[model samples]
Target: MRQRNFRVRSTVVAAVMVFSTVALAQPAAPLPATGNLQPETRAAQALPSLAPLVESVKSAVVNVEVVAKVSSSRGGMGDSPLDRFFGGGRGGSRENVRQGAGSGFIVDPKGLVLTNNHVVEDAVSISVKLDDGRSFPAEILGRDPLTDVAVIKLKGKVEGLPVVGLGDSDAVKVGDWVLAIGNPFGLASSVSLGILSAKARNIEAGPYDDFLQTDAAINPGNSGGPLFNMKGEVIGINTAIVGGGTGIGFSVPSNLVKALVPMLEKEGAVTRGYLGIQIQDLTADLGKALNLPVTEGAIINDVTSGSPSAKAGLKLDDVVVAIDGQKVGSANALTRVVALKRPGTVSTLTLYRNGNKQDLKVTLGTRPDIEGIGKRTPRETEESSKARVGVSLSDLDARTAQQAGFTRNEGGALITDVVPGSPAERADLAPGMLVVEANRKPIRSAEELAAAIKATPSGGTLLLRVLAPGANSRFLRALKVP
Candidate 1:
């Protein structure tokens, strides 16, 4: 049995040796010295091109021209019908017309175009020039400056228009190849390529400041242009470019644009939900001090009296962990989630108060129209005067005292309102806060508080003791009174 097994093993080894020699004796194929052109190499050498994508969607991009009237010392030959008929061509009274340009894309087949609000803002006449050199009078339907988005429509008959496809901005990620198509410097149909640099960027444009950052050569005339992904889908609207900075451009994510467009279309305006609460992020230090298990939540600093949050029993120092079970990790997150909710929607807010999780149902209220937003926003201008403390104080009447959760004997002025840009607002003196004392003196009325502020020594800090309605409410804050 041993001899038979050895014979079988030796035959197998001989066959392997014979095969190895034959393979070694075979001559190698003579090819270029570089390397083998394998299947994968050929496939990899094929670079992705944007030719087809650009060609497919280029026609949908339209050039927006806005003719606005400007003041001039001498009137030019150009005159409006109102100016010509009214004989208002005085040298100083004459107005000059200037044209501004931007870009947009056709969203609907019936000739609805979407662009940035600033493009056609305050224009006396608006026109959209298509790729085929067809110019049509355009009417501004609505605009939302908070997001810098606007929806315009083609007036008169419009048909057979090519529309650009909208992509999911949420699915877009950093390093994804994108193309920005716009009219840079009024040169129409210019295309630039770059990767998405970042997402959810806050440039302090407005309350809803989340934007998508890209390096796609966006410029002044590129505002309202389309930022297309490799799939030829519009994922962002190229909006602003950083001055003196290369490759830093911003775009409004299409998801947010899509959400706001419907409201802009229906009501020609955008309305947000207001919770009426001053909130801050639960930072690491705040979490530690509050004995929170996780540092991801929004902490309520002050709840507005007579507001939805105040009516819903939301209190100071309560950490909002989730909205409708969706986790909230920051103040911005909570603000966005609540703002996106429609008014009259009862949202289940899960809160963490003193290490105990509690659920509160909050009915959202309509956000008031802010001063410098929406289609009816006023033209840009410098603020002429700064507020003293940014707070509007009122004598504590019985109703006001009750609203502030204080008795008539509290001996303080009730803060009825807080100006957006004020020293008091900066010091976190919001509405419904009782100014118990100013300059270490008991504040009995608005006049007393004003006198205390007037007597503040130059460069001296105005010490104030503000009382809120809660367990951990009484606190002293200092504001620099110059």
Candidate 2:
């Protein structure tokens, strides 16, 4: 019996060896290389006539021409239709004319195009011209003024349309090769190539702004055009030009579009979560006072009453380290993360409180239409102006603050106003909130505040003991009086 078992085992081992030999002889083909150099070599070997991805995406680019019909109290002077008929007609009348030209690109085969909001703002008529010399009347899908992004749709039958692919803008590093495709000075199909000069640049174009700085020769007509990477993926939307800088331009990153496009397509506008908390970057002095390990994250300067932050128990001087899983490296990063989230969405905010990490759940609310909410009253303005600081001030008033979706009642003198190109604006004194004190002194009237400010010597450091009702309540801040 033992001899029979040994023969069977030997026979089984021999069969396995034969199978293994066959498997080794028939090896599978090697995986295609993902490296660009190897791929290029293979492509050259396969077909040397093939062009780069830019050639494929070029056909999708288009020119946008917008015409706005404006009705004004001040109308065209002389030769007015009313004046020619009645000989005493008023000059004020409504007239219509073409505004300007910009660039856009088709993102979908169904004729959906993306452009800048300011490009087609208030336009009664919008025409899109394709590279193939076809013209179509386009309708606006949505316009987000804050981000300056607009989506438009072509009405007629559009066929054989090429679409531009969106690339991850976050993946693009400085000094990466990029291409700008747009119509400058009505010149169609113009392309310029350059390197990405910078990324995550704050240009102060709007409240939620992080521009992609490039030296790709973008001009006036390049607004809303595509800024493509070497791989032919659209990484950004060309937006603005820098002052006195040759070949220096800016583009809105594609990540913004990834967040906004779906909302615009479905709802015609983007909705963002609002907390109404003013934040400031942590300074060296602030870090020292807070005893922080590092000067990172957003420090809550003030929280609006009844705001999402206040309801979430966010305290004054609490350093926000992360929001909804994304790290808040700066105030701008936090703002961008919040702006991407929809109102009514609950987000987990990680905060550093007394040198401890804690996460709080904050349900966001709808943001207010700040443009519609007018400035504060004369009395409110007069009172805030009295705050003896270097800044001009005004109040957010009970009504204005409420309408603006503020839930705090500790409202005092809101910095309703700031002079342009002034020290106040530069110091980031915005148009909202309550000011409780000036130069560490409690201020009951705007007159007293103004007196304190006037008494303060120029270039002196001033301390303010403030009561910010929301996230930052009873906070002490110091500012340099320029």
Candidate 3:
């Protein structure tokens, strides 16, 4: 036979396979004399199906339709009868209408539906269609953009509506069978089968991005749909998928939904606990530089002034090992634990500073809205000096300091250029970064920074605190000296 290769295209397609088993003739094995052992033969069992599970939960899955007003600057509208009748066809109204479709599921017998925020956000009118050909209008109850979860209530007398049973997403494991029901391409009651590929996935979709990854065939219209376990319980909400990729999709875990739904119903928004600290995961290189035994905690990069963390005396370079006795293995783990706590909660943090362990109680505050950093023009200067770490440094002038969101008194050695393929570049030290401190000592000028670098023994690590331009945050960088 001629050898040939086949490649599968990137699209969501259903596949089914069947196998037939045949018995072949074989010689019987001789039995032992006294204690003979016999092999047990069992009948072949039928493959499992999702038909009954789909039938029981399909009624709760709904199709969400949204209409919003859009502003267009186009000259005239097309030849629609309504548009011509409304605006005499000269320069039709600039206000146009847009429509979108998504999926949702009923979570309350009183007609309360759970869906994604992007589906009904900014919608002028919203309507929901059921699997039984019943359509009803819906109004947004509350939405949390941070988590991308929304709650909407159907209008009119919607008594005895079918509701989906919520499952414990924390109990789910990888490789567990899962089913997704949604409206794909406006086709209502569509179902897809897959298995849980992973958990606690952070796709950078949002700040709280603990998503359940699956290989389900979720499409554009599957957002806000329910991802069910074999027990016919909603374990996740279908949320995102990779563009131009097949069998890769993500869903919001149901536990997060369960936590936020009641709060959304009571309040219009969610208020998360704030630590007021910028942190990053510790790496082996950073651990070695910091003289730590293990790299399993989140290292504090910066503490906001007058914030909860600052008030609690949490300083820069402190490694948080645990929060409220819960081990924080990574930066994301710390973030999730802190954000799950309510405001005004006094939580104990186990942290290490200078290789010494300590505990501190911090009363978390309400998380504020994320502020945008402003940009500043970089000042050009001819005077520059070279540091041993392959970086060109310059004196930070008062004017340049103030322009870079720093006070005049906070003078430091500004990095003007970084040599490519050098230790400085490898440590992520770039131009436009201001080196404030070296080895726990303040650096006032380029000459001071050079002196600090030279004082360090050859082949030793130099820990430097630096601030990026256009932001009010500081971070530590560890560079190995030659």
Top model by TM-score, which number? 1
Error of 2 at 121 (Å): 0.9
Question: How high is each candidate's TM-score?
Answer: 0.64, 0.63, 0.64
lDDT string for model 3 (189-303, tens) is 8899989999999887677889899998887678789999999999998877776545688899999999889777777567789999999998889888999887899999999
Q: Looking at model 3, which ten-residue stretch has the lowest summed lDDT?
A: 1-10
lDDT of every predicted structure (CA atoms): 0.74, 0.70, 0.76
Query: After TM-score superposition, what is the CA distance of residue 242 in candidate 1 from its true location, in Å?
Result: 0.8
Please tell me which model should have the higher lDDT, number 2 or number 3.
3
Which tens-of-lDDT digit does each residue in 1-482 have in candidate 2?
A: 00001111101011112333446567788876657457667776775332465677788899987653333446432222212111122245533232467789999999999988767655545789999888887767777877878888876678888798789999999999889998775777888888999988887767788889898887656778999987889999887775443678888899888889988877777777798899998766787889887677899999999999999898899999888888888899888889888889999998888988889999999888774533222112123332222254545456756754457544445555554333454555655535677776666544555666556654555566554335455666565443
| Candidate 3 or 2, higher TM-score | 3
Which residue runs of candidate 1 sit more than 4 Å off their true CA positions? 1-45, 69-98, 372-482
Worst 10 residues of 2 by lDDT: 1-10
* Position 326, candidate 2: lDDT: 85
Q: What C-alpha lDDT, on a 0 to 100 scale, does residue 55 get in candidate 1? A: 96
lDDT of candidate 2?
0.70
Order of candidates by TM-score, top first? 1, 3, 2
User: Which residue runs of candidate 3 sit more than 4 Å off their true CA positions?
Assistant: 1-45, 71-95, 371-482
> How do the residues 141-231 of candidate 1 rate in per-residue lDDT, one tens digit apiece?
7777667788888866688888997899999999999999987766789899999999998776667767899988876577788999998
lDDT (Cα, 0-100) at 177 in candidate 2:
83
